[model samples]
Target: MADRQLRTVLEGGGFFEGPRWHEGTWWVSDFYRHTVSRVAPDGAETVVVEVEQQPSGLGWLPDGSLVVVSMKDHRVLRHADGSVSTYADVTEHCGGHLNDLIVDAQGHVFVGDFGFDLMGGGAAATASLKRIGPDGSVSVAAEELQFPNGAVITPDGGTLVVGETLGNRYTAFDLGADGSLTNRRVWAALGPEVTGTTVDEVLGQLVVAPDGCTLDAEGRIWAADAVGGRVVRVAEGGQIVDEVAAPAGLGVYACMLGGDDGRTLLMCCAPDFYEHNRAPVREAVLVATEVDVPHAGRP
Candidate 1:
């Protein structure tokens, strides 16, 4: 059990989410800014594409093409050879915004949506999960999730876990060879008496709405909660053994376990999201941790 209390290593920009570590660099999205950029090891930032609609979720294809979730459009877009194109359009089905995503080792992209207006009064999480093929086709994978956010797969690629934010539950499913889910069951729930967002460092600020979750090779779930402002390490049987604080900020939107050895955690923090201006002061922040746990999954 390893833990640390860290601050934002990099800051400034729009509302940030979807932090993906690829090719020894960190890639994240500024949702409101409509841009997908890469944060280098030296802290240099470069915009890969300024996508249409707000880009929330991001992943890579087997061929190295970039796949993104277009929030406002409620569609999936793929980028290759410096060109952006639509992979799937689901505006009619979702009727809202696509929030975050994770792809499996088999190249299945799992996308989540708000199912309603989260910031402006849509209180419910209206989505099942959607699985997009490598060719950009889409289909419903599972239903009944309330604001599904971040997800991850086991290193063995046998398990799939999703964080249901407003629903206050983390669910796990079996990853089938055909990319279908089986035996969907609750993994953990946000209870009043629970402690520590991380399995280590017992900082007992717990709440409902576990926003984003990632799995370590050590088989731990690092869950980030928007309401709690803490990322918790959930062990087997729903125990929070460690915790990490989100510096001194108003809110913690999402988190990723990346970096050399996978211990470096990057967070998307914002003071507030219910703003009329929509331009965030410091949209995304990058934080590094001493623990080395590589990210496992598609995002």
Candidate 2:
């Protein structure tokens, strides 16, 4: 297949990352703004949760509850109805800020931490990947990630792929029924310079579409590249087959592969650099493009 591309479905921001499609809308997290937004099909956006602690990753539970990774605070927040509360506690164990996450069909939330203060508060290779059960129990899943960021459980829930941003590749693992990971290996590699991110932001992590990753029904895994200035698309075996350019300097963060026909590409874009002295902004764009694939995972 030819490489996929995207147009300006929308724009404007200090930075943007993490695009997830669920319940008829594209949900994204604004890092600097510390808010989670829901976007409409025509590019309109509405902020649903204004989490002050730099929200990055998002997930859902079997009962329709929402969970979010608060990067600055190192806690997970669970949203039910309209209220929020602690979903899991990891401060005493990891002692690092959480970044991105991927929830499996079994109600297990896999989360990653920075390991050290990357923005300058501290320095240590403490990066790791952890997991949280639906009942609020937290546990360690993997240790010593270079920089584990975006992640996803394959369509059949058989494998979990994590984006090691610093390494510029996707780390694949065999999934267990109990939500544990095994046989750690590199499934896809994106050389430091090769990406489709807008702006100068480095391509941190990526997501795999649900509808086709396992069967080829549109089987594809897409990464939200930061420095490459676009979203890069890959086939089943993990190859950079194509890319979609955005106006935002190629600092693409994350994306979702789903829409009405199960093929809309939703993205969070920024012009790179999170404004002189600030962190990246989670900008907006309702529908980045129409991919030839449908997203896997929850509604």
Candidate 3:
């Protein structure tokens, strides 16, 4: 495939994440701005809601209500009829702040946590992935993950693939009907298993730090290489099938396949991922490029 031309879709975000295509618009979470906004194809934008505790992942319930991850307080919030309320509180189950999430068709939300004080420069530790049922109940879906960030469910809804930023791999789980996760395995090994305890050590061993990602119709994953300045499409067994590089001096943290045709690969770009740098600035941008395959399965 030829290198796709990248174009700016939206700019001036205070560190954007969780890019999603819904109802003919692009929905994204701006970390420093403390708000979720919707962007149209023509570059117009509208703020959806403000998450005072900081918002990360986003998904919709079967009824069309929006559910977002409140990172700081470890809560999942629901937005409907212009009001936001707590949907689930998973603080007891999290070791650190929540990061990203994926909502299944049945409204079962699977969310991941930081596993350590990332911005505080703490050592790396394993964390659990929590599943929030449609009834607002929370439970542990999987455990001992190395900073699980982005996630996706298969088209049949039988499997869940999650990116482990510190582990340099994508892990898979058998998503049970009752919202249970079993049969844990490595979906893709981006690099050798990282056994480092410190953030610096882990960063040194990582070849591709997968962050927020999306699934394609061909069963491949388009994941932001958080430290690589690009988004890579990884097939099963960790082969990089394709990639889209970010502009010089910037890093791509998250991406989603969304557009009128679903082939637009929307990337969240910024100077860096540090809170001190991104939170006080608005250099983050949402850029788009065409891809061969459209999106498929749960977000």
Identify the leading candidate in terms of lDDT: 3
lDDT leaderboard ranking: 3, 1, 2
In model 2, what is the error at residue 291, expressed in angstroms? 2.0
Best-fitting candidate, measured by TM-score?
3
Residue 114 lDDT (model 3): 98
Comparing 2 with 3 on lDDT, the higher-scoring candidate is 3
| Tens-digit lDDT track of model 2 for 137-211 | 888888866567777676677888777765556778998988889999877755542333221233233233111
RMSD of model 2, in Å? 5.3
lDDT tens digits by residue: candidate 1, 86-178: 888877568357878887777888888877765555444457789887766788998877667888888777888888776657888999967
Weakest 10 consecutive residues of candidate 3 by summed lDDT: 1-10
Better of 1 and 3 by lDDT: 3
Model 2 off-target regions past 4 Å? 1-5, 12-14, 93-96, 121-126, 192-218, 248-250, 273-287, 297-299
* Candidate 3 lDDT score at position 176: 82
What value does the lDDT take at residue 202 in candidate 2? 30
lDDT by residue for model 3 (1-299), tens: 45789999988999999999999999999999999999998889999999999999999999999999999999999999999999999999888889899998778999999998999989889999999998898888888999989999999999999999999899999988888888999999999879877888889999999999999999999999999999999999999999999988899999999888889999999999999988887999999999989999878
Q: Give TM per candidate.
A: 0.89, 0.82, 0.98
Residue 86 deviation, candidate 3, in Å? 0.4
lDDT value for model 2: 0.66
